[model samples]
Target: MNKTICSVPAKIMRNVVLLLTLLFLTGCWDRQELTEMGIVTGIALDMNKETGEYILTSQFLRPASQSTVAPTPNEPFILISATGKTIPELMQKTNRNVDRNGFYPHNKVIIMSEEVAKSGVLHLFENFQREQNIRSYAWLAVAKGTSARSLLEKHKTSISSIPASFLNNLFMDANADAVSSNLLNFYKKALKKGESPVIAVLSIDEGVEMTPQTTKLSGGAVFDGDRLAGFLNERETMAYNWVKTKIRNETLGSYDFLSEDGSIVALALIDKNAKINPNVSKGSLDSFSIEVNLLTELSEHQPMKEFNENADIIHYLDNIEKQAEKKMKADIRHLTETAQKELESDILGFGDRLYKRYPSVWNKVKDNWRAHFKDLEIEVEVNVKIKNSGLIKGTLLPESM
Candidate 1:
């Protein structure tokens, strides 16, 4: 036998290796170029009660065409919607109307109709995670008083070649300031037990038209498991963000700073952190304590009060801290009470905390934990640090010596 001779040809082996390397290195097998693909910016999910079907609406960035070169009387982007039993089914229906395949990798937002959210969003989201290639960081929101399809169809703004980019930027800003939860955070909270998930809610205000955009984030939606449990106003949403330790550089309204003058002052939250400590007593849950630490800088001052490091400043800060503490406590109390009584679902991830702190206990109590949660006592403590007083040491009011 010729031991030095190879059974297979070296040239064939080399070609195989080259082909394998190319296959692994470049994933261009199904890749499509920008010109060949349609970019989906936003998606809307609505439920049809009559037929128990889902209406999926998508906004696609329309490519430049000869007819659209000059200017169009209509919007730049095109809206397409389809109804089916499932998302994939809807996709098939959608493909019939559009020339290019709907690509979702760059999709910015997922809007759920209130009815759809109330009916159940878990299945829709499961599909999104399993079948769709949308980024985990995209924004998730609820559309108010209308079907998701309506929100998608009403487009009043125009962007240069990319209208969705503008909407994406708006959501990014909102999420950064703790105004809303991004998709990643929403999914994380939603999946966890003993905690409820929340998403920013978009609505169209007939009274005000800030932009040509048809939809705006008015408040936020609270979810118990996969169902829409309740809605939070903008202020409550801000407070919820603070409790979740997600606030950054957002203005928090001041309380009683004007000393009976009834003026309002606002401070920008520079940094904030919140910790939830759960304690078990007598083989049952005793209480959960939430400690919130906030560092803020003065953004707006009213009645021109002075803020020195002296007794006056200390007193003012003390009052401000008290106000903040009161507001935070109220917000937490409302959330807890509502989650326990009205929703009967945990959206706050208390179960995760329990599981982490006392896994053995949680294992025993996990089944009927909702009943126990309602009786669980909760304490909230807020510590606010006024890092900066802005340009002046205090306000310019004549009341201050």
Candidate 2:
């Protein structure tokens, strides 16, 4: 009787184990196949100022017939648009009409038109923030002088079949003409810290007859708490990059000097360092001082004067360095002044820096930081070092020769 009872228990335990094993053998119930999803490479958001409705445009990647990776002359994307009161609503409506589910993990860019950027953008970001499929590192841009959807539709490429890839490649250069930022950092700056954010500007270049239109990335859209305040030209954008220490080696810089016979010197940035110091007096924020140092290689010297001696070469470079410093300082000053006087936006993060060093003072002014920023005095100092001139120290053909 004891052996029979033990056998019954063992059989029950075996059956339970077998049932658990069968549960583990089941396949994923919600797995989506590659063919069942449409890969979105780019998204453009715009607002109808009159109706206040949101217009969402998405670029879906269409794989090449033969080779998916090879560059093709034909455009490999289709533009789909939807309209609704909110971004999420528009996204849902778009999905209802599309054959394949919209997959957004591979998205490379999001462009907001001027209308939407100027009115406000916080609502649009909330949808993107809540969506887990969208990548946080995808670049953000503001469409300039055109609708976001039109820019997306007009964007043509020869480098790669996907225009989004071309757009991503445009921002990869160290000498990028505009500020580069992503959704995560940008949203954090605006929402978390209550700081201003700047996004790169995208514009379409209508090609000449028989030529294809191309896209251009230049300048930046400066925002004051998620609303477009103003714009930063290419020079100002470079200055902004310098202050933020975003500049990298091999980046190009050029400036013109009237004293040097109206000559223009081109330079390649070799290295850079920046120091932003905030002045606080008696628990009160007073001013800020920014010092930037740059080591640069002389890429082009417009003055064709040859240096006959070492002393002459040294003098030439020293004068050029001073002019470079002056040019850079002017650009930086212009950007700061615009931020304070015109835009009333702190794109340079002066207030944020102050908060880090003296939280007490920042707390007092955080509510009205823009007012303080408008009046706050900032001193800009730039020191440029020309380490070497490429190939030749001076011009090959001299006037005397």
The per-prediction tally of clashing pairs is 14, 0
Candidate 1 per-residue lDDT over residues 39-119, each given as its tens digit: 888888888889878888888875453254575555557888899877778887887889988888888878888888888
lDDT string, candidate 2, 1-401, tens digits: 99998999899999999999999899999788998998898999988788989898998876663255785666668888998988778878888767787888899989999888888888777877787678899999999988888766635464665677777877665253577788887887888453588888988878899988778788888998888888988878888888884654356444434545686677777678898889988988778999999888887766556656888878878888888898889889998998889888888889888888888888999988767888988999999998877545456775486
In model 2, residue pairs whose N, Cα or C atoms come closer than 3 Å (at least 3 residues apart or on different chains), thus clashing, are: none
**lDDT of all predictions:** 0.71, 0.80
Over 4 Å off in model 2, which ranges? Answer: 64-75, 154-157, 174-176, 207-212, 248-259, 391-394, 398-401
Please, what's the RMSD in Å of model 1? 4.6
Provide TM-scores for the models: 0.82, 0.91
Lowest summed lDDT across 10 adjacent residues in model 2 is found at 248-257
Please estimate how well model 1 matches the true structure, expressed as its whole-model Cα lDDT: 0.71
